[model samples]
Each structure stands twice: as structure tokens, then as C-alpha cells.
Target chain A: MNTATAPAGPGRGPATHDIRNQIVVAATEHFSHYGYEKTTVSDLAKAIGFSKAYVYKFFESKQAIGEAICSNCLAQLEQEIGQALEGVEQPAERMRKLFKASTEAHQRLLSQDRKLYEIAQSAAAEHWPSVLAYEDRLRALLQHLLLQGRDSGDFERKTPLDEATDAIYLVLRPYLNPLLLPHSLDHNDQAPTLLCSLVLRSLSP
Target chain B: MNTATAPAGPGRGPATHDIRNQIVVAATEHFSHYGYEKTTVSDLAKAIGFSKAYVYKFFESKQAIGEAICSNCLAQLEQEIGQALEGVEQPAERMRKLFKASTEAHQRLLSQDRKLYEIAQSAAAEHWPSVLAYEDRLRALLQHLLLQGRDSGDFERKTPLDEATDAIYLVLRPYLNPLLLPHSLDHNDQAPTLLCSLVLRSLSP
Candidate 1:
């Protein structure tokens, strides 16, 4: 029942953050083996030599722990996509790189941290805030890119930007969706590139 | 272990099929509440007033019963799509109809029988033959429609038909996917038409 060593209040320091990271590391290991749903907070505490209350100080609930993991993974995916899009001037080529990079990045990320996909799948199924926030950011990024295309006169302005961004996001969603990614990576390795080409052609003025 | 009243031998007729249908109906009802993975054949037998042995006679395994239900539901979907396309001239229009019809029909069907979506999710996750077969048929349907567009000079033939079909199918997959469909129908009612227009614009000869 003791949580004296755990971080308290809003003014906690880096040591407190390390405790948070420790809990996440232990929870990830537990979730990877037993899955996110079946493992209880108590099990995680026992695995990490912390009291359940101690664990609670760091994460409000099992879902919060999952959210932390899900957020980090998505951030990594965003970084990979950013690297892929780097120095690309034209919106059309940027669009192509965006598709290919996301597909490849998602595949690599999930494949490497196979356990993380399980957490993400749960996050997606439950509409976790982390997933929603990521979706919002990605959508804004897409809308900005589409605006570039229209402004440069490289793409038609017939379709509303929101609608086009949504449609393109829909097409890319499967690659990002944990439930759908395995099939995409395993069977449809060429899909992202082909779909991007099709979308770009559709955007021609 | 008695299965005295069960139809036997290879010459089984409509009566045998009736028994099979009966099992599927009961299983669907049971699965709707308990879910597919949770319910066993014995539970189905008790619910259907049949001996477990007799139930096994009709369905060699639980998945067989599930397959029957999955196959029937997909058949209904195909029929609905077929009716949507009936008398529609022009491949692009037909394509539009195909997208709209499938999206609408899928939403209607799944919403009307909410439990059925649960079963479908399982079948899709497991890659049941029924799902694979249905995907194949739908792909063939799209390919045929695209070929018609190409022959009539409505669509550009620059992109290979296979790649176009696959890319388009990838867009539609989210709608067909049990995991993704609920979200699509609930939030993206206009996506089908918007995407179809985008794809059609891309196909301009």
C-alpha cells in the first residue's frame, strides 16, 4: 500500500518522470505477453515491485498506460513520415512520399514493436483520445498539403479541401489501423504507392 | 451420442439442408449475445434442442456453421449491390453505383442486424474462406466494370487495370471491413460518392 517513493502533486521532477517511464516499460512487457485487456493494474504492480496505489499515482488507469504507449508509437510514426517527406518541394511528390512513407513506417513500427500494435488496436477500438488527437494532426497536415497543391496550380480545386483530405485519409487509414495493417503489410506491400498515384492523378487540374 | 433422427448418407436432400439452416439460425442467435468465440457447439445444441452429436452431423465444426452464416450474409450483400447496379448504364455511373450501393447496403445490413457485425468481425479477423471468397468476387466485379469503362473509352487505359482495381478496392475495403465499417457508416456517409468522383476524375481518358 506504500507509495511514498512515488511522485506526488503537479510539481514532480525528472525522477518522477522516470518512475512513469518505468511503469510504462513494465506495463508494455505485461501487455505484450498477456495482451492489454486481460492484464490488471495489480498484475502490473506485482510485476514491477510497486503497490497498486503506487502504480495509480503514475497512471490513472490501465487505459492511461495504453495511451502513453500508443502516443509514443504514433509520434515515432509521424517522425518517420516527416523524414520521408523532407526536402520534397512539390506538393504532388510530397503527396507520393507521404503515402509511401506512412505505409512503410507503419509496417516497420508495428513489426518491430509487435506488442505496441496490440495496445494500438485497443486504443483504436475504444476511441482513445491519443488516437483522436493523432488523427486531427494528420488531417491538418493533409489539408495543408492539399492547399499547397491548389495554390501552386498543380492540382484542381473542384473538390473541397476537407472532403479531399478526408477521402485521402480514408484511403490511408487501413495502413494506420492496427486491425488492418497486418494484412496490408503482408499481402499488399505495393498498395500505398499505387493508391497515391491514383489519388494524385485524380487531383490533376 | 445418439443422432437417430439426423439425416445420414451422401444422398441427403432438402431435409438435410433444413437441418443445416436450423443450426445456423440458432448459432446466429447464440453468437449475437455470447459472441462467436465464446459460444461452443454444445451450447448451440442446448439452445436448439438438438443433441450435440446431431448438431455435429450438420456442421462438422463451429466454423462451418459460422461459414454458412457468413456466406449467406455476403450473398445478400452481393444481391443488394447487384440490384443497385441493375439497369445502370455507363461504367463510371456503374462504378459510382457500386460504391454507393455497397456502402449503403453494408450499413443497412450491419445496422439492421447488429449482432451479425460481431460475427463478421470474427470471420474477417480469422480470414475465413467466406471472406476471402467474397473479396475475390467483389474484386472481379470491379475489374469487369473497369474493363467495360476501358472498352467504351470512358476511362483512361494508361494505368493498368489490375493496379486501378486494387487501389480502388483498397479504398472500399474500410467500408467492407467489420472493424472499420462501423466508423465509416457512422461518420463518413458521403465518403463513397466523394471518393468515387475522385477516382473517376483520375480515370478520365
Candidate 2:
């Protein structure tokens, strides 16, 4: 089998993966300076020191590039939440940490890099695959925390677990979402802390 | 002031109001077919058999017309929620009816007239004044309901009234929001009903 003759099959090769990472890095920087909607593929290609065709070879469109950047940013947020919950003894406290860490992570993106936050906002508004995947991971994490609370006799067991998890996720959505961040900020009078407390109360056995 | 010289501020006269309604109706239809983003002011004027300048006399821009339509739709939703809660004596049950009616009304708009819904979707995502006003009225209504619940011995009164209302509003936001409607639909398997129950349970003494 001639390795050179085989198709890359969506960045399967080590060299191709390296190039993809380089492209993502440069595109993120370009988006940060120029904003996601204002920056064009040609602009990204030129900034990355690659031909327009080369950039197109890596991404089908500018949206594809945006999706990649958004996915990375969201993954970082998820990791922050995971670390925030590590070694936490109480399930309710673990949930509070998750909410606080997620809100803080999103607030940083919203304040420090509004351009990147816009990418995430569009991703959520448009239902991009990256956002869908992030939401699924988040729901799973919440479900795990709920189960922990149930087993510890800290939460009611009568409500169906899956439905309760989704309901809980819905309650946290405004704070967790990029688009709804401004809405959350409007009531910045310890709203998140109080919301977490209310939700914890709902879960009490 | 001379009657002829008096400036009619924003839809004052009967004749002017009639023309404005005509423009709104025609623009709503145009937006339904071509979408809000694609349909231009010029295109709308042509459809309504009026000059572009004449259309501008009523509305400053295309977004202004969109705002008018969004305001009307949201007002209707508010009215429906009010009607649904009417005559419901139980505090928790009143909350339930409010949630159901709001969800149904939005579902109708989203499923029946997505173009109008798109106008609403943009209004919410962009934080138009219409939505801001609607949120204020909704919050006020919820506060009233919480007070009812407290007085009737149905819900706990320890949590600050305003914060609890805000938390309940957040839980219902995903389903009520046109932008997040699709996301809510994904979990449409009794998610709304269950979520309402969960919120009501949180209010238990």
C-alpha cells in the first residue's frame, strides 16, 4: 500500500493532524482580532501563511473553522468543570461547584474574548454539532451527580432520574449558555448562588 | 399648539395607525415567505403598493417593523398565559397552567408561523426592547403568583421572593424561548410537565 496515494480521510495522518492544529491555532487568533463574522477565509489563509486553497483543503467553509474553534473552547470549559468537582465530598456541593465553575469559565470568554464568545453564541443559536455534543456531556455529568445524591440519601428518589436531570439542566441553561449570559448578568445580585441553592432544595429527600 | 403643526409621535392618528397596521400585516406575510433577513424594506413597500419612503414614514427601518410584529406576538403570549391562569385557585396549579399555556402558545407560533417566530427569535437573541418589556411584565406576574402561593400555605416563604421567581423563570426559559425551542423539542418527551412538577416541589414547605 502506497501511503502517499491513500486519502487523508479527514486528518487521519500525523502530518495532517499537525497541519489541522496549526490551522485551528491561526484561525482562532485571526477570529480574536477580526471577530468571527467579519473575518473571511481568505483573511485566515493569508494570516496563517497558507494559500486560500490550502485552507479550504483543511476546512470546507469558514463555518467549519468556526465550529472547530468553538469545540475547543467548549471542551476547555467542560474540563474546568470536571476539575472543579474533583474530590468534592457532597453531591450538592459538587453541583454548586459545577455551576460556579461553568459560569466563571463562560464569563471569562464573554468578557476577555467577546469575539470567541460570539462564535459560541452562534454555535448555540444555530445548534452546531459542537454545542450538541457539549450539552450531551454536560447532561451526563449532571446525571452522575444526581445519582450520587440519590445514593447518599441527600436527594428525593421518587422523581424519574432522567427527567430530573434534564429539568436540572434546563434550570442551569441560562447561566451556562453564551447567548443567555447577558440575561444572567442583568440579575448579577448573587443570582447564581441563589439559583444553585433553589435547585439543591428541589433535590432534597 | 396648532393642530396641524402638532407632531404625531409614533402611530397617533387613526389614518396613520390604519396604514401602519397594513404595513405590519403585509410585512408579516412577506417575512413569512422570504424570511425577515431576506425581505428588504423596498421589497415590503412594493408588496404593499407603497413607496419605500412611505414605509419609512411609519417605521425607521426594517428592524422597526420586526419590532412591531414581535411586540404584538409577545403581547398575545402574555395574554394567553394570563387567561390560562384565570380561575385557577390552587397556587401550584396556577403555576402549572401558566407553564402549559405559555409552552402551547410558543409551540403554535413556532410550528405554525416560523417566520413570525423567527422575528421573535431574533428579538430575544438580540434583546430588543419588546422582549425586555415582556420580561419585566412576566417577572412581575410571577412575583404576584409566588405571593399567592405563600399566602395560601402552599409554598415556602423563606426564600427571597424575587430570587425564587427569577429561578423559576430560568427553568421555563428554554421552552418559552423561540431560539431554544428546537433544543427543548429534543427533550419533548414530557420534559416540560416534569420540569413544572419539579419546580413546584421546590416551592413545597
Best by DockQ: 1
Which whole-number lDDT from 0 to 100 does residue A76 have in model 1?
Answer: 86
How many residue pairs clash in all the candidates, one count each? 0, 0
Clashes of 1: 0
User: Which pairs clash (backbone N, Cα, C closer than 3 Å) in model 1?
Assistant: none
Q: Please give the TM-score that candidate 2 achieves against the real structure.
A: 0.77
Q: Lowest-scoring 10 consecutive residues by lDDT in candidate 2 chain A?
A: A3-12
Poorly placed runs, candidate 1 (over 4 Å)? A1-10, A21-34, A183-186, B1-10, B21-35, B183-186
Which CAPRI level is candidate 2?
acceptable
Q: How well is each residue in B1-205 modelled by candidate 1, as lDDT tens digits?
A: 3556433423368888777877788888888777787788898899889999988777778887888988999999999999999999899899999998888877776787776577787888788988999889999999999999999999999888898899889888777777667765545677788788888988988
Candidate 2, clashing residue pairs?
none
* DockQ for all candidate structures vs. native: 0.50, 0.35
